[model samples]
Target: MHAEPACETSLSTPPSARWPVVPLQPAVREAAPRQPATRCSTCSLRAVCMPADLTSTELQQLDTVVLTTRNVHRGETLFRAHDAFQSLYAVRTGSFKTVVMHRDGREQVTGFQIPGEPLGLDGVCSGTHSCDAIALEDSTVCIMPFGQLETFCRESRRMQRHLYQLMSGEIVRESSLVMLLGTMTAEQRLAAFLLDLAARFQARGYSGAQFNLKMSREEIGCFLGMKLETVSRMFSRFQREGLVEPNGKQIRIVDLEGLARV
Candidate 1:
């Protein structure tokens, strides 16, 4: 799932310049609607994205400081390949995918972004995007400018550690994907993918180990480096074996551990 990432500008501006000095124009100063952040403090998924030691005031500041965008339609390009990286994007809802294309006009799905996942960190150090980021469905992402993000991280050592952990998590996922593509059989690859996705959904505070698949089997085949028929057959066989229940776009993991070992 590749998303065209949001463009990020260089953070060369002086510290004082982080917040624009443009006076609030009368038109731009309308009473902004009150939209409070969901009570993440009580959510099970908070383990993945909780701000360490952040106060209620800090939470409000983070929300206010960010330029959150919404209503991005499915199949939309979030950012094109090689776009400049100036901000960190955190997905608030829906799904996204990142891809790398080949000289042969083929595409390889690199990573899938779920809610709370950041997709553009691959180029954070270099200040340029290396892949395309596209939304899989209507989505929302909060854009945090790099300079402010840096300052925030510097001020909060825990946040800096969390950022490193996020990057490290990305590295681990990529390494696993590499191994899955390099040595696993198509059937095994398919099993691993299903299991991984099931685990992901469960991590998102969902029940029945069930959710919808935004990607087609053909896209799954492309990422798995197998034929479309192979992907279909694997799914069919898994369903027949009571490993998964597939009803069009909706899916349920009936025998969770059984499917994991498939």
Candidate 2:
């Protein structure tokens, strides 16, 4: 989520006058791929992904549990449904969408995950993944081996509490989605979805008013239990009413109060 600062070197001076040129050397072979950083204590997302109030010693111990990271490309499945689940993944960068396929072959998007979110919780109880987690963009995830995590959790009360909270959060999210699907209108569902995204982004140190949609309208519709056309219409209506402004996949909430009232 950190943006590379723009290089702002002045070009007023000629290159020859600004610095001395060195003679070219023999060309070297391509370097090996760089490994991602695995230290949780130094990670920018530790606050969001790890348990709070963890001492330096605790963080170092936790780092031992998360020993590696895996990169998943856009549109690629991180893990398919029914895969034997061995580890939980914490999003280090980018986002993902979890999908469940019906017997009729229709795919339903269950949830969208941003950076710092956890995936693979669906398999905690059954020991087999119940859905597919697909990367929405080229992303990296810290792999926490569940066995080691469980052992560590037993030793650290804080970690055990945090693990329980994560499971509770998953239950609450699913229940809320059920309520939305069963009791809410399409407009209300979409409004709540947008508001929820805004709040999540704000919690992650991003702007609440403006952000790009990582999931497509069709994906959103699937998650919201609405048709693609209905999802598009809702966005158009929100724009027309001056509650939001949409340009392609980008959205800006122009009137937070108005959107809340929807």
Candidate 3:
């Protein structure tokens, strides 16, 4: 059964730090416009809404508007590093990888974006983005104006809580990545990555143990701090051990328990 939207949280995120609502602005209508045909590049009701829930009137307004759709080709920037953090993006269709370059010009991939996932959210202060978000395939995104959304969030107690909840999870994910890349062996890292992806997909309503990998072995290696050759070898090693049946992009965790053991 689909879950009822969680009650919005009331948090102490200081509204003074960001955009505050003003009287000069036109009063937001009770019924607003919504984009027709919520496409993959367009967010549906679940993923984007997590940072907050919409009132019935707001939903009606949203459902009436037409959202802009833009295609970002593979390896192209959706937004560059240090760009003005003006918008929050939702992966409507396709996938994205966020990367940051080191002082020495090495690229470190920060995270991957899947459908229904929100991005560019961690940027708020200083109005500058810290990383480059790139499309892995031809991708589409829902560009939500950050200032307006934050203004709405300030008024809605629930929305504020949701935003923090989302941010907190991102922090946890990044911290865990640090531990994984810092110490785990190649085999262990690969297994952990798969398991992590499985659980995440499951939460989003897909079969947890079975899914196609949108990232190539090389990209996975980049994220994991391993070489492309090391990633390939680990995959072969896992397959030989009967822990997974990887057929091209298709990967089935034949022995999830076994993989986790590594």
Candidate 4:
């Protein structure tokens, strides 16, 4: 059996004069809705997302705070660096990548968010988004307006604790990434990355051993601190060693222990 990760992991933002906000184009605003938006109590992702201990009335309160779902298309920018931040986004479907531009003009992949994941926490401390969140595919996110969320959190200890846990998890995940890049060999890093993804998918009730890669090899390499060529070579090596089987962007872990050993 594969070791489970504590929670989903990822890969933030900048400080400056807040950028002039541009309204999302009408066409972009209306991507075909995947499903009719539902209340928080009825949301399928509530188990992994909201506090598990909330009472029925508290769940109803949360539902009122969430305004609606917003659809983001492949390659669309959900929020850009320096944009004034007001809401936190919960991934209702698909995935997103958070990236920051370096002073040297290169972009760094900060994190990848799957379903049930939240983005825009970077803004809490600064009041402006420090990174850009871009959708990897057609996706939808529930909008949790921070002001309302903060009010609700104050009245419920469980919800407050859950919010702290999410923030704390983000901090720990970042520290782990630093350690991962600082100490681990390329192979170990790749193995850990795949295993992390597997655990997250399994948590979402998907097959942990098999899944599609929403982020490309280039993006994965950027996030994992390796070259694209190196990422590809590692994939080939893992395939040859029977650690995993790759068909295009889809991968299956044939030997979970073998991967864990790396």
The 0-to-1 C-alpha lDDT of every candidate, in the order given, reads 0.67, 0.81, 0.67, 0.82
Please name the candidate that would achieve the greatest lDDT relative to the true structure: 4
Worst 10 residues of 1 by lDDT: 1-10
Model 2 stretches with alpha carbons more than 4 Å out: 1-36
- Of candidate 4, the 10-residue stretch with the lowest lDDT total is 6-15
Q: Candidate 3, residues 26-66: lDDT per residue as tens digits?
A: 22222222243463223443454443456765544443332
Best by TM-score: 4
Ranked candidates (TM-score, high to low): 4, 2, 1, 3
- Lowest lDDT block of 10, candidate 2: 1-10
**lDDT of model 4 at position 93:** 91
lDDT per residue as tens, model 4, 72-131: 999998887777778898999999999877554567687899999999898798677778
> How much is the lDDT of residue 138 in candidate 1?
83
Candidate 2 lDDT score at position 196: 97
- Give TM per candidate: 0.79, 0.86, 0.77, 0.87
Per residue, candidate 2 scores C-alpha lDDT tens digits across 126-176 of: 677777899999998888889999999998999999999999999899878
C-alpha RMSD for every candidate: 10.1, 17.4, 11.2, 6.8
